[model samples]
Target: MREAYHDQLDSIFDDLAGICRRVETAVSLATHALMNGDAAVAERVISGDVEIDVAREQVEETAFDLLTLQQPVATDLRTIVAALRMVSELERMGDLSVHVAKVARLRVPDVAVPDEIRPTIERMAAVAEDMVGRVCEVIISRDVEAAIALGRDDEEMDGLRRRSFAELLSDDWTHGVEAAVDVALLGRYYERIADHAVSIANRVIFVVTGHHPAALAEQ
Candidate 1:
């Protein structure tokens, strides 16, 4: 019975990994949809959110089952708890991708993305992508060191998020208020995504190493 339960735990882990990959694709599509102004791609990202939602529910079910069936202890207990927490973050990331797609759909014509903030938004997208990628890697390999490294990378994302907001409110962006609003919203989304990614990493560290990583001063 213990052997059967262990197999069940492993299977749930695999399912969680698939959830990560799907979300990564959703985010990438959302980024391209934003950059190209492709209505089809924006629609695709929005539809993809349904899949993320399904995955989130499935994961929650599996985690709850494992807790009751296996009655996991110590590290094993942490594994189920961590998986549950990570799924919440992953689902939110998917929702943010959908939000970006919605914003893209709204800004198809007038109010082109201003010249000043495009690069910053692009950087934020890249950071969001990288954070999701690294978090998945940390989960797949159970590498605490890699998770720590990703946490550091999140700092750069925070810096970019902050600059994007500052530029939006400053006189530097006088021409496009609507575009400024989009940039501000998109920046906040990416920043939140990055935060969730870092949380997943920290949870993994706790699962494997039995402790949380150092808290970065949240600005």
Candidate 2:
């Protein structure tokens, strides 16, 4: 029974890692759809979100069962609790990707990102993708250092979001109000995705050290 419980615990992390990979793919596909105005790809991402949602539910249920049945304590308890939070962050990341795809879908044949802002959006997408990928590694390995480093990536995302806004507000800006709104919202979605990845990383730190990242830094 002990071995079985451990196996179930391992399965929870495994499932979380798999969900991170899927969210990474969703971000990439959504970016492509946004850049190329590919409604089909956008629709693919939107439809596939249900799979992510279902996976999240399964992981959550398993974690809850383990908590209820095994009554994990100390590190094991922290791991289970952190898994719950991490899985939710991953689900939110998936939802953010879906939001990006929805914007692309709404635009249909017309690309949602204009030429001036495309570079910033592209960079945001790349950074968001990289963060999610690193998140998968951190989840599996529980590397506290790597998890903490994700904050730097989050910073870069914030800068890119600011750059996108600068472009929108520039004197030379010619895109209409609708396009501007899309650019602003798209930048926000990507930034929020990165934010969620960082949140999961922080959770990993807490699980391993029994302390939040902020408290560790103060030491």
Top TM-score model: 2
What would the TM-score be for candidate 1 when compared with the true structure?
0.93
Worst 10 residues of 2 by lDDT: 210-219
Question: How accurate locally, in lDDT, is each candidate?
Answer: 0.83, 0.91
Candidate 2 per-residue lDDT, tens place, 27-122, comes to: 999999999999999999999999999999999999999999999999999899889988888999999999999999999899989888888899
Q: What TM-score would each prediction reach against the true structure?
A: 0.93, 0.96
Return the TM-score for candidate 2, rounded to 2 decimals.
0.96
Best by lDDT: 2
- Residues 1-219, candidate 1, lDDT per residue (tens digit)? 989888877777787778888888888888888887888888999987998899889989888988987788987888888888888888998999999888887876433357677898888899899889878778788888888888888889978988887888887668666777788888888888888888888888888888777753341
What is the alpha-carbon lDDT for the whole of candidate 2?
Answer: 0.91
Q: Give the true-structure RMSD of model 1.
A: 1.8
Off by over 4 Å in 1: 110-112, 216-219
RMSD of each: 1.8, 2.1
